[model samples]
Target: MTTKTEKVEASTKIRPRIGRWEVDDHNEVALLGTRCAACGEVAFPEHQICVNCGSESTEVVRIKGPATLRNYTIVHQLPPGYERPWVVGYGEFDGQLSVLAPIVAASRDELHEGLSLSLCVGVTKVDDDGEEMYSYQFTPTKA
Candidate 1:
């Protein structure tokens, strides 16, 4: 005899804070970026024009994780509606484009330049409407 498996559907469908990042049908999160057809340079937030060569031939592309931590710092003072004392840093992806995002680490000792980081999405803050705002962050790679 075999046991039957049951499928549970999500009660509520979640959406991203910004449409740039989205969870695909496979439940995989991907950051949307723009690539210049002329110079082959990529830009985040899906640029309409290429910032490098000023080319209008920009195409939207999916940028996947495994970025390197170039630099980071702990922010003591935070803006309104933000959780204070958060770590912010820049992660270099595709060996060219560096994206600034929150860094999630257990301790500062686990953070350093050239450290491997994987992109992840999580709730950054709650809006006045009580909606959960999501943002991308870089977490330490697991060995």
Candidate 2:
């Protein structure tokens, strides 16, 4: 089966929304996080200050996959430069951090809280310049 990163690499003009993620040599996408040396808090998007302990010293770390979906809602309306009728939800990873991300599913009925989900690299939208904005989204795990 084709992986998410392989789909991303197939795109002609794929660009990440932020610099916090990248596709590795194996075509697996990984997210960069900041782990505080003082409190061992891991913060996504690699923040300078630790959200848990407010520590200024932190190092970049890779976040693993297989997060659990806590909750979600179908968005009928979309923001500027985005598509319509998408799912957004919060995913809890490692029991320490809960992150809000786009929930990608075959249908809205397939989404629910406490569902097992995993990170997938996908195109959120195509900009006016025709660049595909690659970002992370949570998808229901296959049984």
Candidate 3:
């Protein structure tokens, strides 16, 4: 018997992003946003010009904890880009920021608008080569 090993590179799938997301060992996920110090408006992915007040002073911030499922839909058809056959949606957090993401509930019955939810980091799927594509999703919270 012989054992073989293979080294895999991740450049074939979705491009990796930086500085716009946060993940942990527990699989919680959320969009990283920035806040404008001069105008006090929150911006996703660190905006230099404040959209609301036109200010240039901003700082990085993370939107975590306590999000509500605002709306969702099951996507059967994938665009020329992106994944398919997934329930994708957006949620409004307790921090008054609305973030759109994939719905990772066990079933459709588990999703509803205004449902309390939690963020988690997750692997989208495994490729034919057994490579894992990681992404984020929101799950409904318990009563």
lDDT of all predictions: 0.74, 0.76, 0.66
- Model 3 / residue 125 / CA error / Å: 5.7
The best candidate by TM-score is: 1
Cα error, candidate 1, residue 81 (Å):
2.2
Estimated TM-score for each candidate: 0.79, 0.78, 0.71
The digit string of per-residue lDDT tens for model 3 on 1-143 reads: 11011112325544544225665556555567888898788866457788779888877787785688888889888644345678877788766567776777547777777788777656665656666655656777756
Runs of candidate 3 with Cα error greater than 4 angstroms are 1-19, 24-30, 79-84, 125-131
Error of 1 at 41 (Å): 0.8
Backbone N/Cα/C clashes per model? 0, 0, 4
For candidate 2, lDDT tens digit of each residue in 38-57? 99998887888998899899
Error of model 2, residue 77, in angstroms: 1.0
TM-score preference between candidates 1 and 2, better one: 1
lDDT of 1 by residue, 1-143 (tens): 11011111222534432436656565455688899999999898777889899999999888877889999989988766667778989999868789988888637788889999887777676766675666777788778
| Candidate 2, lDDT over the whole model | 0.76
Give the Cα error of residue 129 in candidate 1, in Å: 3.6
Instruction: Return whichever of 1 and 3 wins on TM-score.
Output: 1
The residue pairs that clash in candidate 1, if any, are none
TM-score quality measure for candidate 2:
0.78
